[model samples]
Target: MSGTALLLVLAAAVCHASWNVVAHGVSRIGTPFLWWGAVASAVLWLPVVPFTGGLGGSVGGLALGAGVSAVLHVVYMVVLQRGYAAGSLSTVYATARGTGPAVSAVLAVLLLGERLSALAAIGIAVVVAGVVATGLVDRRPRQAPAPVDGAAAIADGAAAPASTGGASEEPAPRADAAPRRRRRLDPGIAWGLLTGLAIASYTIWDAHALRTWELSPVSFMVGVTAVEVLFYTATLGRRRRELLDVVRAHWPRVLAFGVLSPMSYILVLVAIQTTPVALVAPARETSVVMVAVFGALVLREGSVAKRLTASVVVLGGIALLAL
Candidate 1:
């Protein structure tokens, strides 16, 4: 990638992570925040849509791609919500986001006939390893206080008359509070996998669509945003009110996320158009590293040391890919 393209990718990575953090903070209303994001994004792309000429030869293909993208986005949103609910954002987001570009790279090879250099292959491996390590480390059991015996509880209650002893009466922690045994259908892992697949599908399909159609970027973006709005609105129905509530409650944040997300995507498209897909995809994956850092430092949600280490590993992978 040229220096300009690389810089644009980096900027997009930052935007990607920031918007994800914003999304994580949204009130849990299935599909509501998504609709809000779509609407906001559409508004942003509206002005540019007018500049795009009427649909031509590849318009159908692009529209079909947009429809596919909308479905994938819904799936991605579902998984993202489940993942955030079930696991630490640091771990789930990093793993999901990091694995996407690697999957995209493979799909690009199979479907788009894109090739990866040796360095890029190594970089992808490193990213995958880092994602695995991050997830495993998060799965480690957290310490819980031992259950208190009845006699001990009585004695502690009796001793509570004395200020010193009562001060020592630490509440017995419930065993149930311990991390639940990993189910066969671990929601976090499932969601992470789905997220990866959704993103991979989006990237691959979008790439093909772009190649097939000569539509201006703004026009393509508006079309996709419109499709997304219709899909989410139909799927969310009565629940749409709940989504509206979230928007009303957090309009500023939602709007910011909406702006950043589409802008980041636009930047990525620009970069991909200018550079090799191999280069742009891996570079964009660096958002995983940024998200890990943001989760640890900004969100303050996980073990700082583990998050930092995982982030470094992810960055190392990106570096290798860039080489």
Candidate 2:
């Protein structure tokens, strides 16, 4: 990455991380929050379309690319929201962000004919390894109690002070619940992986769209976001009341994210215009570390020290990719 591109990507990382934190805060609202944000993005960017010179090439081609990107973005939003609802902010965010660049790198190599340096390959592996390790550690089960021996249990009970009659007895733990708890799916991790795939699809698609159509980034974002809002509204028609509730409660945040999401991606798109997507993809994902930090400091979802360690490893990988 060149100096200017690196700076742009880093700035975009901060914006991306900040908005994701905002999104995770309202993850329970899920698609409602995203739909509103998309609406806000559309409204915010529409006025600037003309100023940005609008679509400068084939209108049909631009619309086609925008449509495809809009669909992929919708998938990304749904999956990311599911991830936030199901897991800790750090783990889910890390996994989703990590998966994007990794998949994007593969697609770029195979379909886009992009090449990577030896250091970049190693960096990508390190990033993938760190993400996998963090996910594994996040999913690790806590130690369950050891079985108590009858003699020991009886002795311990005999030595304990008698409870007062005024005190209410606590309910016994249910043995039957353990199986159900164990069987429950970690939707966050599952959705995080899916979100990565969606991101990779759009990343490659957007790159091709930009290269082929030469559309202004501003106009392209405006068109795609408008379509995404329409798509969300059509699909979520049944949950209009819930969507309204979210909008009434968090309109400010919705607006902020609406602006941040596109601005962040626009920066990445600009970087991609000048640099290889292989390099830009991983560099842009430096946001993984940024979001992990926010997840710890702002959300307090997990161990900050542990998440920071994992993030450092991810940054190391990004640095190598940059080299």
Best by TM-score: 2
TM-score of each: 0.75, 0.77
lDDT measured at residue 107 in model 1 versus the true structure, 0 to 100: 84
Q: Compared with the true structure, what per-residue lDDT tens digits does model 1 show for residues 1-323?
A: 47788788889888876776666634333356667777888887777555555442477776876777666665665565555555444345546766677788888888888777887788778877776665455554322222221111000001100001112356755787545553235554566676677777777777777766754555666677788788777777567567657877889876885688787787887777656665677677666566656656776756778877977887788677656
**Can you tell me which runs of candidate 1 are displaced by over 4 Å?**
50-57, 79-95, 131-136, 140-187, 242-244
| Clash count per candidate | 0, 0
Superposition error at 121 for model 2 (Å): 1.5
Q: What are the runs in model 2 whose C-alpha is more than 4 Å off?
A: 78-94, 133-137, 140-193, 242-244
